[model samples]
Target: MGEHPRRRADAQRNRDRLVAAASAVIAEAGPEASLEEVARRAGVGSATLHRHFSSRAELLEAVLHDRVRTLCALADELLTAPGAGTALVTWLRAVVAHAATTRGLGPALTGYASDPRFSPHTMIREAARQLLARAHREGSVAPNATVDDVLRLANGISLAVDSLADATECADALITLVTDGLLRRPANG
Candidate 1:
């Protein structure tokens, strides 16, 4: 016989609560945030958290998955934004800031880039590619600019951001410098 509808609905609710709690906790405490706190915040017991996520890694993947979805959604929305250059710049800043603030996210993303459960790299790459293509068409970005070039550059900057005393400013400054140079010059130039 199939599982009871009420029981299934309850299970889904618990899972949703756990993920929401985990997102907030992870944002505050980084990737190593305590699972116990996640459970408490979600109003679920430890056993329930364990039942939903077999291990810390599993829970981390879920949180990371949500972050990846958010980033991609932003990219998709920016595709139709008023200015292609502005959209590209905004999305790139968001990507860099996300990596900078989310301590351990870079390493986790690298380790799991190929994992379907958390394919941040692949998804972000496609999103960036679309943005870049739009910018190129508008003559704002260099036509030859590839997604690999920008992502690699941004990834390197985020890694460097780890040691800087002021990470957000550093990320923005560095991205601005690079973008200013990478963009196309005006007719007068």
Candidate 2:
């Protein structure tokens, strides 16, 4: 028998729900967590989770795509802020804060070795490139800095923070120091 139209739509909804819930859960639990656990957290059947993600790597990739989109949107919105320095600072701080909470992102998607097209990472990089270019042109960021360099530094900071047992202060300090280095300096200095 043909599947009912309502049934197909409901299945799609279940898939979307599973994807979103799995993203959050995996960010906390890492990619090795059981699919049944993900399903339970998502309030969906294990079969439903499998239908959407198929495998752990697929779910991880989907989560990275979602996060990349979110970060890119944040960069786009921040780029239009009243002050360029303020915008850069705000975005950097947001990245650090986001990094502190989200596991595996530093190593998986944001690193220099990772493929830019790995998930929606290219979009995020392009967004960062545009913002960093503007920040440089506007004399808000260091002239010689590339977006890749910034991301590398951010990834390094995120990794360092991730290792500390109680690193809230350390994370904040490191992010602030990096932000200071990223700032533009006057020619006369």
Candidate 3:
């Protein structure tokens, strides 16, 4: 019994290491980074990598899922922040930053768009939706602003800068454009 539990723990550790390695390799070389590199980085054999992740997509999913969870948690926490619009803007910027820094992330994460139960795409949308809803209630942003709009904007920014040198910094500035629609003010001054 103890041996079985130990094996399970070891397997879990291997999975964690694989995920971590995949994340780093992907971030460095883009989504098309070699699987062999991942296994080597993880200090695991190719067979072990295959055992943990059948395909590159699955491994990417795990990485994106891990990051998405943290992003969602941040969105939830920001709900109580003083400025709803600013909080939403802040979260969106972070989302864009993640996308820009993590090359190929947009496509990798969007691959699960149809998964009803647990999709990184769905998770991010729902998180943004929550923040957008609060912004709507507070009349802090444009009434027509949707989570789709924000996400699309983020994706576009990510793509535009994917080949650029200072992509992350570029993404940070470009994300501010999204606030134009979300935080627009009346001209009744």
Candidate 4:
């Protein structure tokens, strides 16, 4: 027999809470944040958290998936905004901020990056490509910058200074440097 509708709804609610709580706890306490605390923050018990996520790795994967979905959605929204170059920079900064929260999942995320089921990898790349193309046509970005270049630079900046005491400021500085580099410049005056 199939599960009851109320039971299924409850299960879904629990799962949603766990995922949201995990993201918040991990962001505040890093990847090693306790699952028990996540449950507590979600107003559930540890058993409930485990019922939703079989393991810590599973929870991490869910959080990563959620982040990717959010990033891709933001990219789509930004594409329609005015100023291609400004939109791209805004998207890149958001990516960096997302990366900051997932810093502890570095190796696991790397593994997921190779998996075809992770659509965020493809979606992000396509978004970057379109943004870069628009910026190039508008004469805002340098002619030679590729999607890969921008992704790498942004990812590198996010990872490199994420451990610093003033990580936010450091990230802002690095992003500015990258933006300046990507921007087109005129011939000598």
Candidate number of the best TM-score: 4
Q: Cα-based RMSD of the predictions, in order?
A: 3.8, 5.1, 4.1, 3.4
| 85 Cα displacement, candidate 4 (Å) | 0.5
Per-residue CA lDDT of model 2 for 125-145, tens digit only, reads: 687787788788799777988
> Could you give candidate 3's per-residue lDDT for residues 117-141 as a string of tens digits?
6677778989999999999999998
lDDT values for all models = 0.84, 0.72, 0.83, 0.83
Ranked candidates (lDDT, high to low):
1, 3, 4, 2
**Global CA lDDT of candidate 3, please?**
0.83
Per TM-score, what order, best first? 4, 1, 3, 2
Mark the regions of model 1 whose C-alpha exceeds 4 Å error after superposition: 1-10, 106-118, 164-166, 180-189
Put down candidate 1 lDDT per residue, 1-189, tens digits, no spaces: 999999999999999899889888865677778889999999999999999988777777777777779899999999999989889989999998878767774455345433555566789999999999999999988778889988998888898886676787899999998877766767984
Q: After superposition, how far is residue 154 of candidate 3 from its true place, in Å?
A: 1.8
Model 3 per-residue lDDT at 92? 81
Runs of candidate 2 exceeding 4 Å displacement: 1-9, 97-102, 105-121, 165-170, 180-189
The TM-score of candidate 3 is 0.76
Error of 4 at 4 (Å): 3.5
* For model 1, the run of ten residues with the poorest summed lDDT: 105-114
